[model samples]
Target chain A: MNIFARIGYAVMTVLAQLGRLALFTGKALAAIVSPPIYFRLILTQMMRIGYFSLPVVGLTAFFMGGVLALQIYLGGNRFGAEAIVPQVVVLGITRELGPVIAGLMIAGRVAAAIAAEIGTMKVTEQIDALTTLATNPIKYLVAPRIVAAVISMPILTLIGDSIGVLGGYIVSVYSLDFNGSAYLKNTADFLHSDDVTSGLIKAAVFGFIVALMGCYNGFHSKGGAQGVGNATTYAVVSSSILILAADYVLTALLFHK
Target chain B: MSTPKIQLIGVKKRFGSKVVLDGVDLTIEPSSSLVIIGGSGTGKSVTIKSILGIIRPDEGTILVDGEDITHINGAARDRVMRKFGMLFQGAALFDSLPVWENVAFGLIQGRGMNRAKARDIAIQKLAKVGLTEDVAFLSPSELSGGMQKRVGLARAIAADPEIIFFDEPTTGLDPIMADIINDLIVSTVKDVGATALSITHDMTSARKISDKIAMLYGGKIIWQGPTAAIDSSGNPYVDQFIHGKAEGPIKMAVKA
Candidate 1:
């Protein structure tokens, strides 16, 4: 085939796949609205996917905020604006750095784990077993993960933002030779509630995307060990890319205000 | 004398252009064992998967308890599944869960029984399968191949399912271990009074366990009769399969 034919075929193939995915998504949504919610399963998954993820997110945010503060001090000093460290740090962490960093980290950890767990289940016919047992696999498996990710991500982002801000605060007050009160005032002045809100909203959306990609990849996974490994790799890579893309779009829309 | 526990009528399934099953029909009587013998790629697994609704048939019906479950969904599917237990080709135990949890998976996860109660039943099932209580605390990966199959069997009967499916259950184990598992399956099925449907290439297993034996070739059953009559079924395909001879009506589908 010529270039035009090749391009057209690729586009058609992608369209076909997307249509199938949409249909599957509709089935999932239907399963969601149906009775027998499995609240206990949701709570169990929340503990595993969300609550347990705190330490890594906190540690990453703390160091990221600290390092960001130091970088801004050096960069701003070149322009005789070292005093802007706190304002820059707070805006950067609250609006961009905190959610994006925490999101990327979680996309790697949670996505891979969910894919592997579900993939193993798929290969062994446990998922099929559930279906035979008359349990809606969507409600029992997919819904819990999706709900947990959506609810837990915002909380994780909130905690991460606090730790990130504190990390910047420590650096600004100690190493940057700035008055603590002035630093606090600039941070408060530069950042509004919208910036923080947008970041948290992005975190929740990213969480859904992360969990969705993981479950989608793993649930459809084929072969055996290699198929599961591929699902894990695809989950992490795809979710990370999607997070970055989403961050840009959300930022452009939010910052336009 | 009772109605067949499972009846697959004119079942047809195709994957794209490749037809996996072409108008297949089968029946398994209650408390009786049926073994489907076929080659590796001749759709033995597809036949089982179709009955379970894991792979939907393009045409025909799968009936359990005289009810068609082929196109069924939702709570009805689960209700049907509760009556069925399966021992997969591999043990297929959840590695993250302890041995007892894996055994009690159906009881705890599907039925929502208390873990303590589920754990006690799991130990009993494990003991029935010849594993001790201490072995229940270990992970599935910690167990050997034979041990895992035993664990898988334990899980299958955990809920006292009315029917059981075993897929190549004896293929990977040593001869003695395979026979041991086969015997366990025979005794357990009898003990629980469960109908059994199995597929395997092992004629020894087929002859030992099944009262009725069917040979699947070219996506259809070529011959099916009592196990005692298999040797004299006089069908070339059945003769080739049970005798393990390659130079008859059965031809290997090698790429070369």
Candidate 2:
């Protein structure tokens, strides 16, 4: 009976958390449409969330693409189907690796950063100070971040996709001794626009998840430094999980015949 | 008589199982300073937060300028908030912004003033707070605690608000700095002619800045009177607190 009670308590707690998150998301969405849109803040957030993230996202995409090409060549060689490397690499890079990898990397880098920054602001009563100053915290803080993430994620993912395909091309031509022009032709011919667009759509959703989780954890943070630390960790962990979950759902929706 | 600039009637707030404010009723006359004093964790901050609409009271009403603003939100709340400024316990300056930008935040964001004019006013306000124009360009993190408090004070008065709240303004300062802040509080409130509400455990600050003083204990204002009359309030709790007595009706919740 005690075990059952504990299980029930845990379930209830999880539900309560979900309810709170839903409300926070709704308020953030509403704030986006409200007056005083804070275009400057949104642009600043874009530079922080998107522009600063390029190096990390680009490097990760490059490595992932190279590794994927090598593995696909090696595995296809075993099956006597090594010639499928170009088609598979482009398809894999565009449809899955680019968005998912970029999203998870940002969940670590950007989400944690957002949480820590806002959590410190909250703990120090800067959030309350904003309130006293007649500034809507959601409008001033959360909306800008969410808008920036949504706008920037797809752009980042597009760059990541191009870099990732380039990585695969480099590895296949230089290391695997494949004809570089033939590889490029195969990748371009086999890859439909839908594959790239699907990944981009996923990237945008992942961005929303990352920023929302970060801001939500931050706004709710309590105590002081330890609480902000916990918020940073929670923001990364939750957003990473949500990003992958979202990726799966997006993939199924975008690619299912 | 003119309506009290701020009033709290039976304001009650609780956090989970902990009741922080049971039934707090208080009033501040226009252009006068009132300070609420209490031990740490006795709801002094909560009282101010409730009045500021940062914390919602579970029961009762809060009136600002005689308008019942207990549950007003969105634009109405923003409009009400425009009448107020607050210096948080930690000064709470935006580290992302330089001192001048921090001071000018309310003017730029809330009032939609242009940057050049706002920067000019920010510098003036900083000078009023004894901060030089060079300090205005430095980030808040670069300032000392006392300077941060001064910058916060500058920000509070930048828009010439109707009311200003000081929360533990001198908590982390040395004695001389605390006295300086208290003096600044008195001078600045006079300068703006703004009604002032402050919460602090610092009795000297309360005595120096407030015309009226209220002592809060166990979530209630147990004693209140003119600053001069505080010595003769005859309330044992106020007597205990003012004298810094450990053995009295007001007991500390210290445990071994």
For each prediction in turn, the share of the native Cα contacts (below 8 Å between chains A and B) that it retains comes to 0.55, 0.93
Decoy 2 TM-score against native = 0.98
- Quick one: best DockQ, which candidate? 2
Docking class of 2: high
Candidate 2 residue spans exceeding 4 A from truth = none
The TM-score values for the models, in the order shown, are 0.93, 0.98
Model 2 reproduces a share of the real contacts of 0.93
Error of 2 at A133 (Å): 0.6
Identify the leading candidate in terms of TM-score. Answer: 2
Interface C-alpha root-mean-square deviation of candidate 1: 2.1
Task: Name the weakest run of 10 consecutive residues (lDDT summed) in model 1 chain A.
Answer: A128-137
**CAPRI class assigned to model 1:** medium
lDDT of 1: 0.87
Off by over 4 Å in 1: A1-5, A30-35, A38-44, A74-81, A252-257
| Tens digits of lDDT, candidate 2, B1-256 | 8999999999999998889999999999999999999998899888989888899999999999999999999999999999999998999999999999999999999999999999999999999988899999999998899999999999999999999999999999999999999989999999999999999988888899999999898888888889999999989889889889999987677631
What is each candidate's DockQ, to 2 decimals?
Answer: 0.51, 0.93
Q: In model 2, which residue pairs have backbone atoms overlapping below 3 Å?
A: none
